[model samples]
Target: MKKEYAVIGLGRFGGSICKALSEEGLEVMAMDMNEDRVNEYAKIASHAVIGDSTDESVLKNLGIRNFDHVIVAIGENIQASILTTIMLKELGVKMVTVKAQNDYHEKVLNKIGADRIVHPERDMGRRIAHKIISNNVLDYLELSDEYSLIEIVANSRLAGHSLLDLDIRARYGINIVAIKRGKEVIVSPLADEMIQKEDILIVIGAVADIGRFEKREMQNDY
Candidate 1:
């Protein structure tokens, strides 16, 4: 069965989520205070409505509690975001995801029982910065404040070496979880497997360790 979703504040983040869910043939109701924004998503989302989610009555009228998941993507307005999240939880929405502006806002959302708090802008900035600083780093995903998963293009230095020879876990305190070569992906790669130049290494480790490995090993080769 397709899960139903209600997305409040039809901003970039919310609109994108709505569009993706609709593309997957899920039921999605997009809402925003601005009629213009609601109108824009009417053709894309299953339903689009102009209403203030901060008001419990408005949410009730929209049948928001019936949705399986609700996303509070109210941009800039922290108060409305908090109120809506709280109301959704109180009304027994199965899940509530919210976009937090900063650390303080995130703390408040956490206290108010938001199922997930996303810092999209801040996370995107970090990913872009990593890619800009090193040609080897293709992508970065923060698993936590200290740990991250990174995709690095294997350089000449890494080529012709097996995982056993590199002893990457012992030396760098990181793990090569997978290797992507061309269209093939080798997950949980064996220790005897050799790395080839341009092979994409999917590594996971502490942020500091990953940084050190990239700077001392990958970047220095070029």
Candidate 2:
């Protein structure tokens, strides 16, 4: 069965999601307060409506509760975002994801029962900053405040060393979850598998440990 998604706020964030969801054949209802924005997404999404999402009556009329997942993507207008999220939960929406402007807004949304909170700007900024700072860091993702999943180029010195030889888990307290070589990806690599220079290691560990490993491993190469 095709899933249904509702995206409130026709800003870049919400508009992009609606377009992608519709392109993938999911049922998407794009809602925004601006008629122009609603019209822009009309052809992209399954349905598009211009209405104030903070209004419970409008939401009820639109059957917002029927959507499998609702995304509150309102920008800067934290009040409207909070109100819409509260109304959606009150209407018994199964799942609600809100785009938060800050940590305080996220805390408030969570307390009001938002199922998920997204910090798009902050996340993107972090990823970009990491790329700028390190030439060997291909990508970075935060799994939690304390831990992260990072993709780093295999150090030349560490090349040809097998997982068993390094014993990363016991030695560095980090896990080599995956190895991406060119187009190929190896998940849960074997203990005897050697690290090739072509390999991009997907490691998960505490932020500090990962930083230490990067410095110790890639310092000379960079």
Candidate 3:
């Protein structure tokens, strides 16, 4: 069955998600209090409506609880965000993902049983910082405070070396879960597979261990 999604507050974050989901042929309900915002997404979403999600009656009218997932992306208005999230959970929505303005906002969302809390600004800053500090790191995703998944470009030093030869798991405590070469992706790569320059390694491990691996194996090698 196809999962349905409701996105409250048609701002950058919510708008982007609606567009992406719609592009993938998913059913998306885009809502916002602002008529202009709702109109903007009318052609892009499966359904777009001008409604304030903070109002329990409004959400009920939209049948938001029936959606498989609801994303609360109300910007600046922290109170509205909290209220909307609480209402969605209470109404028995399967999942509620919210955007937190800050640490205190995230704490409240966690206490209220939000399924996911996103700090886009903070997370993007961390990703950009990692990329700035290491030329090898192409992208970064934080799985938790302690763990992360990163994509790194293979350099000359790592080229021609097999996973067994590098012993990355034993030495760095990081696993190359996948390798992206050109347009192909090899998941759960074999130990004997040789790494070549320009290959992009998708690795996952503790954040500290990943940093150490980048410093010792990638940065120092060149």
lDDT of 2 by residue, 26-116 (tens): 9999999999999899989999999999888999999988899999999999999999999999999999999999999999998999999
Q: Which candidate is the best by TM-score?
A: 1
Model 2's lDDT to the true fold?
0.91
TM-scores for every predicted model:
0.97, 0.94, 0.94
lDDT, candidate 2, at 183: 93
Question: Predictions ranked by TM-score, top down?
Answer: 1, 3, 2
List where candidate 1 sits over 4 angstroms from the true fold: none
Q: Write the per-residue lDDT of candidate 3 for residues 127-152, one digit (tens) a residue.
A: 99999888999999999999999999
For 69-132, candidate 1 gives per-residue lDDT tens digits of 9999999999999999999999999899999999999999999999999999999999999999
Q: List the residue pairs that clash in candidate 3.
A: none
Q: What overall lDDT goes with each candidate model?
A: 0.94, 0.91, 0.94
